[model samples]
Target: MTTFSITSDNLFMVSLLFLIGLLMPTLQIAGGQSIGVCYGDHGNDLPPAQEVIDLYKSQNIGRMRLYYENPGALQALRGSNIEVLLDVTNDKLQELNDPSAANSWVQNNIINYWPDVRFRYIAVGNEVIPGGSAQYVLPAMQNIQSAIVSAGLQDQIKVSTSVSTVVLGNPYPPSQGSFSGDALTYLQPIVQFLVSNGAPLLANVYPYFSYVGNTNSISLQYALFTSPSIVVMDGQFQYQNLFDAIMDALYSALEMVGAPNVEIVVSESGWPSAGGTVETIDNAQTYNANLIRHVAQGTPRRSGRAIETYVFAMFNENQKDPGIEQNFGLFYPNKQPVYTINFPQ
Candidate 1:
């Protein structure tokens, strides 16, 4: 029977070692650009949670962002060393308005399966800007973040909300990005909060949407990121494609409000393969293929930063809206690539 002495020095050493252990994984994530796929299951017909995870591994995806806190998905991804970013639904936004509910939300959903599940980011809600239901999103965001801090998880798990490109008033020129006049009212305070708290501004950008909506106006090659185009320039800064255009839209908006250094991450961006896109299956293949390669081989744009991107989904969700965008999956439901995509090669 050996009873070790408990002293301040011993406790301090233990705490330091624990922190270092925690930082080891963070270092790995920051080692290079990391990519993720959106794991939206608005469909009951998709594979079981665990099987879906296996499918993710089969495709060599290392990171994913889920739309809910369903335990089954968390349970499956727990020991996989994959990063899980969870979202609290817009309807549940009001829950965060109450401290107790917010605390419980983080405890039950976030902290409950922490280190084991590799939950890195808790997306407060999805696309808080455009949705009518997300009107209560600003205050709700504050409350959820308060919960994150209360649970002592803020340092480890980040809190953020995704915004659609609709938030941008002028997204094309990149240098001229601005939040829409209507959305600016709600977004100002939200952006201020995020800036104060060090959360990434997530933009759900889709060139397919831009092109499909304005087919006669824009070129397919530009949307695919493969064609050479004139950079929309403000003096010397040149943005090439929709990706950079959308990002700079937000960047310019943020800079207008004086929070220039706040990090902006592409929470969602992708090209659909299976159906309903004018961009040809070959274009989808080539576009998505090159997009992954470019993202993997990330480099600084004129602003001196490496771009962050997440291709839409791992599998084609049949239960999703029958529209073409709903079919925006890189792989078929059978768990195989829709086309050849060079990942980091």
Candidate 2:
């Protein structure tokens, strides 16, 4: 048998090899799962960040999306295998619009954590344009990206904003979809930024919202990702569920604007477990489980190119508004799953 002794020059190589060994298994598992979860901490009763991280690991959850740069949450995520998307909340958009402020925020929230946290993106502002924070969204995004560049972390972290499905106009035909109303002006520039930066368009697509808005027309089965009685026809495509329909519409809208190469990341999408006329444990499970399986297979129009998706929530948020707002969690406040769902290992 041959034995090797460690030397000063080989120490860094050994450490790197050990770190890679530790992370490779986890990285492979996460890569296979593809699906991610949104960690919304609005529930007073929700467990601490450490416990939440534990739950994620136990479930083999590889990706997580945070609503803000919460220190405690980021700390808990440190050295974990899960990849994260950190946010700059809508209210903070104005503050981060300035290059100096954005740099400060990056140093304080992201760079400060570094490789330990595995932060992949800085979601500049959540649903800002439609919510009237349009003026600040693009500026904040640019500033933050500039900050990342300044910090020498641009290659490791990307920047983009999460937008609502409401930004689209007449999204039915998919191919005919385009940004409408006041959104067009803001979207044109935003998409340009995304294209220039080679970042994805972060979209929060909710078939639930579409169904809620038109209950009489939108079938519950379609929203739930179950067997729909009627299949929606859009050009050469046949949509069995509403998720793909909404996604294709966004794709079409991007193509129309000459930003066809810009990819989309479904930043948030899930079914509520309660607080709605149709919301139920079974329905939530069905929608989410089917989503996991569906996203594994890319949209028909964009065959073989699976769109990365993150489910809306990890736990039921009690602090959210009454009705359907607080019930989109996959787990309870205790960190237990609301229902069983598989993440392919």
Clashing pairs in 2: 79-116
Best by TM-score: 2
Which stretches of model 2 miss by more than 4 angstroms?
1-32, 228-230
Per-residue lDDT of model 2, residues 103-186, tens digit only:
899899988888788888889888776556788889989999988888888888889988887788657566677887778888
Q: After superposition, how far is residue 157 of candidate 1 from its true place, in Å?
A: 1.2
- In Å, residue 323's CA in model 1 sits off its true spot by 3.5
> lDDT of candidate 1 vs native?
0.66
lDDT of 2: 0.78
Clashes of each: 0, 1
